[model samples]
Target chain A: MTPAVTGVAVTGVAVALPGAADARALLHPARPGAGPVDPAALIGRKGLRFKDRATQLGLHLAYAALSDAGLLQNGELTVRKDRLGAVVSSNLGNVDTVCRAVETISKESTSALSPMDTPNASSNIIASETAIRYGLRGPNLTVCNGRASGLDAIRWAALMLRTGRADHILVTGVEPDNEVTRRLVDGPMADGGAAVVLSRPAGTRARALLGPVLRTAQPADTAHQLVRQVPGGGLWLSAEDHPVPRSALRNALNSWGELSGALGVVQCAAAAGWFAEGNKSPAYALAGAAGAVLLAPEGTP
Target chain B: MTYPILGTGAVASIGADADAIFDSLCAGRSGLAPLRAFDPSRFNAQQLFEIDDRQTEGIDEPGRATRFLVEAIRQAAEDAGLPEDLAGIPVLVGTGLRELRTLELWWRDGVPLDADGLHFEDALRRHFGAVDTHTFAGACSASLYALALAWDLLELGEAETVVVAGCDVVTESMFGQADRVQFDPPPSVRPFDENRQGTILGEGAAAIVLSRSAPAGRPVRGRLHSVAVNCDAHHQTAPDAAGVEDAVRQAQAQAEVTPADIDLVVLHGTGTPLNDRTEAAVTARVFDSPGPALTGIKSLTGHTSGSAGLLSLIVALRSLERGLVPPIAGLADPLPEAAELRLVAGGPLAAPLRLAQVNSFGFGGVNAVAIVGGAA
Candidate 1:
């Protein structure tokens, strides 16, 4: 069943995946912040090192989101720390750090590994770090629903707003497109980050522009659909009844196959991919894996 | 304000399924047995609420804990009267240490050193199918923490229903660590007894299907009026006697229901020297006159680690249904405070009903108390 809008609205959306060929230019501008470098300007910043690809992507997407909403004012994000919530969702919490730590403690001598980055590998480190970095004191939650991480992040943040937990929530789905996540996930690696600013009722100019927002989860034919994706990633209606859009294929991550959880992240990021839809007439947004979240332009059927 | 419990499931010494297990408890049967599974020959103690070797003739397969989760989810769904499929539901799983038996026995014992804590999602995703989120909270109070999360969601109207579960299985780490801490009992477990030994090792899982709308089919199990969980921040493995009282007070205040409203009380009753004495002291202060009947499951179920809160909750619900309070199996001669409340030894009872409280406080001072009753 669709939740009644109850005056809620989406004000802004942003996405960033550090060094994703495209994010590389955004990550390393010739000048620190000279409006982000273009492909032509990508020449000077080749070896700018980041601690972990996930962190780099997380910061970039968060910044992009802040920029898109014109919420960045003099280096300060618009959302107040007290009224904002953060849900930075990831499948593998700092996979690079986890691999390194495991190798150090279990296989190799404990002294061989720098006991330093161990804390960063913890699951909620990203959420904790994000909250510490920004003064977001609202709900700092870390959600894992496999491929539904991104969509779940959006769903959770939106709920927080609707529940009066926060005025506007910042939801970012981040995972390094690293080799470890790729091998472990066993399918194509989903390496990117996406961010959205979900506002309380009547908080956005988009409130005047949006039609009506609706969210619902289609059932798994079996019992365990959320944690584990279904075969063929759940039943997709080829839509002889409604003409399934080509865009749905790009955003679908319903099954328990490889990257099912990460697919939710991808869909959330791609939903804000305004550039991906040049000729398409329908506006769209999505986040989550198990119970895939479908956010279309206000009035779209 | 009271979110109804639409469905429930459990795994314990009595049985794997809810009906079987609850029936065994009502019958006053003891689930404690020799530690046969995991080759207890190498260990010091030979007692536990082990459910492993029972696979051949009793439970189906995949060990007890995993089976516990699978069956519990199925039963909870059925109990809640939801459609057979799990496509649209949201689930939150709680555990202190997940798949402890798998990691400690398989990963730590024989595997390559780095093979520990492998990708856990494959199994979780496979079992839950279409969950809203997959959360693994490691705190001792993890399961009840999940309950609180589900409760807040339901109250806020974010979702009408949520399936909540807490599970654990016996593991070498659990066995070794528990033994190292000198937390084991002598062949048997005794809570609140003057000559109480230590705790007996136990592992199991419990799941509950909760919704804003109460289910109509089954007799009303119990109403969760209020739940309050607090961290002690005291010593890691011990609880402050005074803090336990505060937790009860917090829950009573939050529910706006007084201690007098409580008709039955389920203590954490860890059976440890400090824990037993503290639980007794706290109960005395909470209910001075006509105190609610006191009962505990540690004797029957051992200690299921983090999963104990929900497990005890299931028993409490069952007690409310039978119109009787089940006995604390191994409690032969009870402590002074324990005797204050009617210890329904020998079998279940039939009256003085209305309200009950279930307490589960874990190491690190993580304390959770759930108050329930007919009016609640």
Candidate 2:
């Protein structure tokens, strides 16, 4: 049975893509290989020196989104910590850490493994670190579903809210550029991430309402379903690594290169930004096979 | 909005089937033995509870962990009486560290690595025809995370049937890492016992089928009442007693039951000094003096990493059905100072079981708890 559409709204969003600081910049690429943003420069340098790039990018986007939502003032959270939950998704979690562990064990002995680096090897530690930093005590999860992870994270967070598990949730996706993932995938790899702060529908500062999400066996079918569900002149953002063909609807790639797990949320943020502007047309962000999310701006017919 | 656990299956070091495994666990049999699949001479720990792939039926491949997962999922679906065509069913799996044995072999002997096997996600798609598949990689707590996600999907009415599974193999990489970090318990594992050293690595797979309603013919084991997930925000390997206590309290409140209603506590019990101590401290603080009987299955099956939590859940449900709690293997002498928890030792204790709680904590401050109420 398909669950009811969550009456949740995406109040604020932030993105840190390659060569782009914000979502608008993300839509318009500047040059070849935007390169990763210096995470320390954006979110301070202390204690972040040894942290993996994934964590740095995730933290940067989350803080930026929360800041945009007015939840953070004077570098402090105005919302209750226990009421906040976080769901972070990534395809290749801390690949650099895993590679480093392999290098260390190869060079010396297994005992030479750094204690600090050992725990970071786990994928979920990125989300855990974020929670620890902000003291968010609500439901915390890390989903690693390859390219579709970002959309799955959003859907899961929405379910948490619908079930009264949390009042607010930070839905995020982050994947860093690394040689290991580069060798595995075919397209241009990039380090980028996007975060969206979701809250109950009755709350203020609503940017867009989260429409029903469709999970089908085929990406094209899911796109068609989204079109039928929200029939209008809206943009269809494809965040998949592979091209999704949908000639019937106005479709476009994320264009910020291949962010893998980070692409889905980035696409959602882009659609939200599109609606945030005067454009009343609804938008849907579709991820790798089976994950698609629709966003309808407030007051949309 | 709770959901019923329709059926369960397992492929562990103890046994391939859940009922046989539970019987062995009740009989106080240990699957811990010397590591044979790989050479563990360099590591401080020389033993592991390794499951022989050759012995595991339906395991076509030789060394890949994917085979174990496939076999386990098939057994679980069959046990649950799921239709043959499971095209759209959601499959949530918890997978541990990447299988690096092929790469390690390539690095050591210059042998060409076999890249034929699929990753965890691909394997699920190919094996079970799962379309909406989500894999969780949270180190040791991976299976618990998967189970929690399955619970949410069922409660939210998003999925009528969800398959939650987890699998990991005893790779050389895991042994090396465990040995380097001093997480290896030499000789054998001893939980909540004085002079306890640490945990031993194990390999296996376990799967459970959950549905919004009960299946026909098969008795409902229990209803997954609530799931509470949190992070310690503390150290990586070491757990904060306060964080664990908070998770327990939150889980109880969500289940709408106090600690007094719990009949058993299935602990993570990695058998490591830090993990056992922290869990004991947390349990003592949360449950009453003669609180829910504390028991652990790791002493018998070893720590199966990603699959440990699901295995614990299977054991707890079986205990609820049989009204008996299995003894904590290798726990000869209970620690006198840590007497706050009523640790179940000696042998299987026959009691009226109703509600069971399972606790799972991973390397990275990830804490997940689930409360299950036995069927009426």
On TM-score, the candidate that comes out on top is: 2
Fraction of native contacts under 8 Å reproduced by each candidate: 0.04, 0.42
**Runs with alpha carbons beyond 4 Å of true place in candidate 2:** A1-4, A33-35, A103-108, A239-256, A299-301, B39-42, B54-63, B98-119, B171-174, B183-185
For model 1, the DockQ equals: 0.07
Q: What is the DockQ of each candidate?
A: 0.07, 0.41
Give the least accurate 10-residue stretch of model 1 chain A, judged by summed lDDT: A230-239
lDDT tens digits, residue span A143-218, model 1? 5445445555666566556656567666777666555566555554545555666676644343111222223343
C-alpha lDDT of residue B112 in model 1: 30
Query: TM-score (chain B) for model 1?
Result: 0.90
User: Which candidate achieves the best lDDT against the true structure?
Assistant: 2
Q: Candidate 2 on B72-148: residue-level lDDT in tens?
A: 78888887788755787888888775444434444454445332221366667677777787777777888887887
Residue B275: error of model 1 in Å? Answer: 3.0
